[model samples]
Target chain A: MAKITGQVQMLFDLNKCLGCQTCTSACKTAWTDKDQGQEYMYWNNVETVPGRGYPKGWQTMGGGFKACTNQVDLSAPLPSINRDYGAPWEYNYDEVLTTEGGDATVGMLVPAPRPDAPNDYSSNWDEDVGAGAHPDAYYFYLPRICNHCSKPACVAACPRKAVYKREEDGIVLIDQDRCRGYRYCIKGCPYKKIYWNPIVKKSQKCIFCYPRLENEDPENPLAKNFCVTQCVGRIRWVAYAEDTTSNLYKLVNVWRVGLRLHPEFGTEPNTFYIPPLSPRVTNGTAPRIPTDLLAEMFGDNCSQTFEQRKARVEEVFAILEQERAKVAAGGTSELVDILTSYSESDRIQL
Target chain B: MPLWPKDTLTTGRSPRVLFVWGANYLNQAKGFLDVYQTLWPKLDLIVDLNFRMDTTALYADVVLPATSWFEMWNLNTTDLHSYIIPFTPVIPPQFGSRSDWQIWQGLADALANTGVVFQDSLPDGTTITRDYATLGTDFRTLNTDGQDLSDDKDACQFLLDSSVETNGLTMDGIAEQPARLLETSEEWTSDLLPNQAYYGFQRMTEHLKPLHTLTGRQQFYIDHDWYLSDFREELPVYKPPVDADLYPLRWITPHGRWSIHSTYRDLKFQLRMQRGRPIVYLSPSEAQARGLLDNDPVEVLNDHGSLVAHLCVSPRLPAGMALMYHGWESYMLKNNLDDTSGFKNGWQGPCTIRIKPTQLVGGYAQLKFRLNYWGPTGNQKDTRVQVVKYAGTLP
Candidate 1:
């Protein structure tokens, strides 16, 4: 393993996500849509937890370091082209136009048949299907992008060493010019972040919008990461982990409320999640999504991690509530000042 | 007053000819496409003037392309914002397409050449006949005679120069900034002003001036004849929704978060995030009762019509309520079954549910005859429906 320097990190608060997909659309329009090879690729995606994600069943295919044996498993079955990533569907508008009209009571308008096979699955195949029964079912959106890990498996498995972690920000990127179409990086990633571009005959993954980062001035607190600034829910925070004054550091290290996804993979992922808080069901009981299932997805410490995160979130909510009361009584509080000051100068520090 | 053109068409008294502009009837109206299909042969002509080759344009006897927004000069006023915005063209209209204003002008000129006469009866019982030649000459004169306001730019300039609302503002000024603040009687110190009254009502409190009302003051009760009619809806009162008890689920279709109405609904990048199809949201419990699951094909049916969409078990949605975001076109929908069909294979276009008409009684003060003021409105939210698992293939 190589010693990493200052690492850029991100935290997503699940409690705030509205599943609007503004972040996904923004990323696509900015980066991927121009290339024909990038049609099936989404560097960022929001999938419903406890549901089949994009590429159908991505969670079961395994890779990354095996902690029990203390060695990386380079061999893993690659994601399927047909079953995993569904072909994009195109519509038949001309058929709807040319069809003849029927009688008033029986007239109908039908379009030409859709292109069948190989494209059956879509990006959000299982949307909103949660784990619980009836009125008590609970689900939350889990937005995924490349983790840009401290110990990226893609870097280790590439035969040509095309994948490398930047020393400056610890962002993992594939060297497109140096790479051949071996797909070893795709199998090596436990998160399934690496995607194969058939047209380019190369492997590609998220670059954390590194070009935007290069343009950012350290002195400007308002200079934000692409996904963080584009989020309509305001759920994401991004900053270098070494920047002590950032909200990212305060939330991740000082408060210890942010939990890394699947820590057992031994990849040291930079992205973190603030577990969601579900409201009590209409049956007047605490809503529950089986703890064991969460543990399976998040690793063995899921219960303890969730408890610590929930307590800190409750504290923040209490402060917000108290400040709201003061505002109602025609008085201002410092809590309001801290929350409202999101301008460029106040949000970040070099 | 409650009569819809569809009802008239169904009764075999359809219009002789139809001319459509600035509206996508197939996309916005319920059961409109079906009606068009049935009545296409019966009608003499169907003309459409639109920018895109939308569903309605395909069926038109003559499809005249209109200028896109970026190629036209326009003004927009919105209640949500304080400024009046102007849209200046970036380029000329492409591929022989004309601006809506120019197209209408040409049509008027051509009709005048036909030497037609139009007769109308006035409110005081006076009948008047207008010669097309004179009417056309008068219309053209407004754009000519040293004014030279034949083009859209000249027309827009005249509007800015004449209106007191836009005092001290010009077309050039608006073109430079894209928006201008509507001037008020107050002194000019700031570029913006409060939307409503900025100060307290001193005239009403200190001078005791009468309000603009029927009694010259605020009145809680209305003494209008219609208000005291058999319905007796004189004062505001609680009334349950019309279809509250007819069906198990209340249907709600709110504006989509991705687009404004149907404006950007078809953007490929935007559609990728929305599962490439329309979705109906339901609670897990409600879904279980109907044998539905996430991404399962389901048909939402009511007396008005039936639409097929993939079901989504949304935890945020409440029980006994179904939600579908508005603005998906009929063509985008799958297995849009007709209401008259008895659960058999039917057309596969987008199916819009039935719309109910609200109260149409008018003629009272504040409710007198006016365009878009007092008329029958579509009661979209007042709908009930049942969901059944669909055993259909995707289109």
Candidate 2:
């Protein structure tokens, strides 16, 4: 593969996401709806955290690189389309609506859960059902798409060398002609973003709406990704990773707020996240989300102990709190302004 | 019924022959079961005009096939934005369906064929009397100051020309792109400045325009007789919920993430993300206490009525609360647990119409009766219910 000079990155503020699935629907309508076998695929999906995510137990699925190394693990289990990702089932709308007592008094509209495929799980099966006891319960929305990692495992795992990251913008794409439908890339991606198109007999994933970004017309206003532009919460920002002036860079580098997911996977994900903040207790000292859980998700890729990671996450929260206090006291905060991104230019700096 | 009270059913008159169009009131309206059971039997007729088989159409005596939004010409406006969006036909009406305007025109023609002449005097000493022989022709040409509006496109143009906000907007221009309002009206008392977010009451705050009140300012206290009477609700104050002590769980029905109210709630694509059915969400602790598991069909009941749906154990919900995201048709329920045996349908039926007497106020400044302007909203959040695991069959 060619050397990737720079990559387009995205920052998602979990605080703003309402989990309305607007972005998911937008992505589906724009890209996946055209194909036959992509019915069950969601190139972009928002799932409630602390719950079993899309493809069920994706976080535990063995894939990506070995910890603390740049080596890809070839031996990874493939998720069953029927069992892990529920095959798209349709309703008998015509039969039920036309049959006797079809007014739904007697002859009901039975969902045809295809007998060949068990419709047990879906992309957001356990949506909004987070973990915790009452009165102190906690949950946040995590919208997922292809990370377009700097060192993508799919690119490394493709035996036929079909998957490659673009040297100019670093968007990982599979060459349809070169791909032999080996299904290794689907297994290699730890995020489980890549899906197999049974009809086409190839793997398909998010392309980040590259055509819109690559459009030569500088006057075209709608030059952003569908997921970013259609996001109802306005929780997303996109820019070239190397653009130091962009808010994406400022949030990740200067402010030190945006953290990558599963750094141990060693993909160097271009997608960074501003972690969801916990409401302060009565004393305003501790965070509601267990420090261990936060650390487990957002901790460093280095060999840091659980205590060290916990302390680091706590310190990040403290910084957030201090900045919030500074703003409350009528002082200007760059972090707050960058995160808010009131203007369209602030959010989409191609 | 106080003169200056807050929140009441805005429409003063009871509707006998309801004509539901585009709205799924049978499924979405609060205390709908009560209205259906008691009031429906006494109603003269119920007609629903829809492109799809929605819950309202199932119960309606006459279901006229109306053109879908994609197959119609209409003007759409939003309070959140200043733009007047246009809806143009992507395709003509399918399967012999007619647009709403055409449907009414046809009805007028039918009435004219029956030779039934109806007349009513308007408040301004004008008469609504029309000869049955020319009813069809007059219905198309008479309204909106002698403009022909029998066709959907012509009606849309008439509406655009009639409204001050969209007075100058043309169909071609709106079809190309959404046009911003020409100016704010009395109803929307805000200046729609270019490149600015829409905020309510900008005219009063930013421009210092007089507010529509007796004092010509934002009034906090009401000095009406009913306000200072035995009720003594002169100022807005927190009142303890009446049903909180009686019922253990508060039943709150919020709009779902998958739908806009009840629209597209039954679409297969939207339901696939959900549990393939209507579900009542309970806190994990509440579910545990009731010996219920996730995906368990349960009956949520109260003094008003009962509804059967699948239970989703969600930690996002707080204890002492049962939440069902609104917008599930009555037909969505499979195992009917109502009193009637042999194949009945359950609905969203736990809510009761709790009309606070204070809400029935009228004849006060800005409190006079107007359709949905200032009235008691259908307050369903305060309803309380108990959820128990269902021992019956599931869909």
Candidate 3:
């Protein structure tokens, strides 16, 4: 693995995410709308786990490092434009407007008929359809962007050597000028985040809003990434992973509550997720989500992760409960002060 | 005015001609298209004045375009917030469109040119001729020094200058800094939270002023004769949902976070974030019991009518209740293939569920007639419906 200095990392607490898609819309308006080819591209997407993500069935696709060799296998099936990434659909406003009405009848409005294509899926196709039955069903939103991994499979699989990670901030970016649309990086990426813009005939992926980060004054404390700052849920915390005083460092290194997605892939993903803690099921003490399914997503350490997360959550709840008692007695708690310091100006720091 | 106007249209006793201003009835009103069709030829001269080519404007005989929000000067205040926001024109009104105030002024001018007269009886049973031409002059003289108040800027200024709540505030001040709070009375001022202007009910409490109630106090017991004789609701009481037992599921239509009512529902990017059409959320078990899958076209039906939408089996939703976020345009609804004629009459299927009427008791004390009060409150959530897997495929 190549060593990097001052790497910026992000931690997303799943419990706080409401899945409102404010971050997704903000990223889209800032970067993607100008190009027609970029209509299907969403650099930041929030998908319900235990659901078929933006591009259908991304979890099943094989890539990343082989477990035994820890080497990138550039032989995975390339993401199909039709089957994986669905085309955007348009509505039929003109037809609905001109329709004549008669006694006891009203005009109708509906989406335009889809073109003759086998692929019908769109981004976030299985939204809100989490696994399990009623009264015990479970789901949590997983917002995905480029992981900017330490050992990027996309960087290794690129035959043209167009993909590279910045030495300064560890942001993995594709060189559009050098890219010849070989699509090797697309096949090598296990996350299936790289998109092939047919019109531009080049590979494209997330840049982590590097321009915004680059323009930030080093003296300023309120600077933040576009997605991290725009999140309506306030679930995202971003800072240099090495910065001991940062929230990211406190959560990942000190508290040890955050875990990377699919750590078994061995890319050492920089984006970490705080796994969801579900309510106890009525039938048993087990959580709402089946234990085996979570194990499949987060690797064999899922049980240990859950145990640690549960203990941490209980500790926080205990603090809150104690704080409530203190407030009732006309006093205050330092624990409450620590948790409630989430004003906009203090939410993100350089 | 009745929202549905079912009795007024069906009886055919009221005026035949209709003039609709800002409202998009074809999308907003229940059974409006049916009423329009039933009284088509008989009800002549349907005029619509709106900013966009909305459903109502498309069906009208005369469609007069009105200025869009960004192309007009207006003052806005919401019950939820303390800010008095100003909407100053960023660009001139597009071709053939005028502000609503300007349109009304023009109509008044035309009436004055035609020499119209007004006659009305006083409370003491005296009737006299009133020169209606003065109405046009009165509207034209709203601004200072006989300036043309028909202009939208002057009209907005007149509103700000005349109201005590906004007397100290000016359009220029708001233009420089939008969302400035109105300068209210001294008692209403908040020292701790000065920016928020925290005072909605200070007059009644601090000034010891009487409330607009029969007892002139915060009386819990309503002494209205109609409340006792008709509704029997002398005090606040909890009444169970009217049709909860009729169907298996209760339907809730709440305001969407994406739009205010239906205002920004048509924004392309906002629509892209959604399912691209109306969707109904059901609990996983409820969907499983009906052999339904996620994104399956489902028909939600009650006694009143049925509409088709994609089903989203949500774990967050509790059993025995279905949620459909409101403000989707009528045209964005999926058509039901079961309807043989394909007439599109049931576009608002989810909203077609039977609405239970609130007690019609009124005309006494606090129950007396007033704008936005003492009338039949539409029971939007008092609906029950069953969902069936729709046979047709969704685009």
Question: Best by DockQ, which number?
Answer: 2
Tens digits of per-residue lDDT, candidate 3, A1-350, equal 25677687877877678888888888888888888678888889888888888777877687788872558877767878767777666665655554355322244454333422344566766666677766777888889998898878899889888999888889999999999999988888888888889899998988988988888766754655778878888888777767787766766665555767776666778887766667789879877866555555653222345555445545434444577588779887543343344565544655
List model 2 lDDT by residue over A1-350, tens digit each: 78778799988988789888889989998998878999989999988888778888888887788875777876867988888888777886765455254333344555567322266667787887777765566777899999998889999899999998999999989898999899899888988899999999999899999988887466756458999988878899998988999888888888787877777777878898777788754445555666677777775453566677677677777778788889999998998887677877788887
Q: Is candidate 2 or candidate 3 better by lDDT?
A: 2
Ranking 1 against 3 by TM-score, winner: 3
Instruction: List, residue by residue over B7-65, the lDDT tens digit for candidate 1.
Output: 56468676768788887665566444456456566778888888876556655677788
Output the better candidate (1/3) by DockQ.
3
**How big a share of the true inter-chain contacts is recovered in candidate 2?**
0.50
Residue B7 in model 2: lDDT: 29
lDDT of 2 by residue, B197-252 (tens): 77888999988998988788998788787877857898898877875426789988
Residue A149, model 3, lDDT: 83
* Model 2, position A92: C-alpha lDDT score: 68
lDDT of each: 0.67, 0.79, 0.70
Order of candidates by lDDT, top first? 2, 3, 1
DockQ of candidate model 2: 0.42
Clashes of 1: 5
Best by TM-score: 2
Q: Order the candidate numbers by DockQ, best to worst.
A: 2, 3, 1
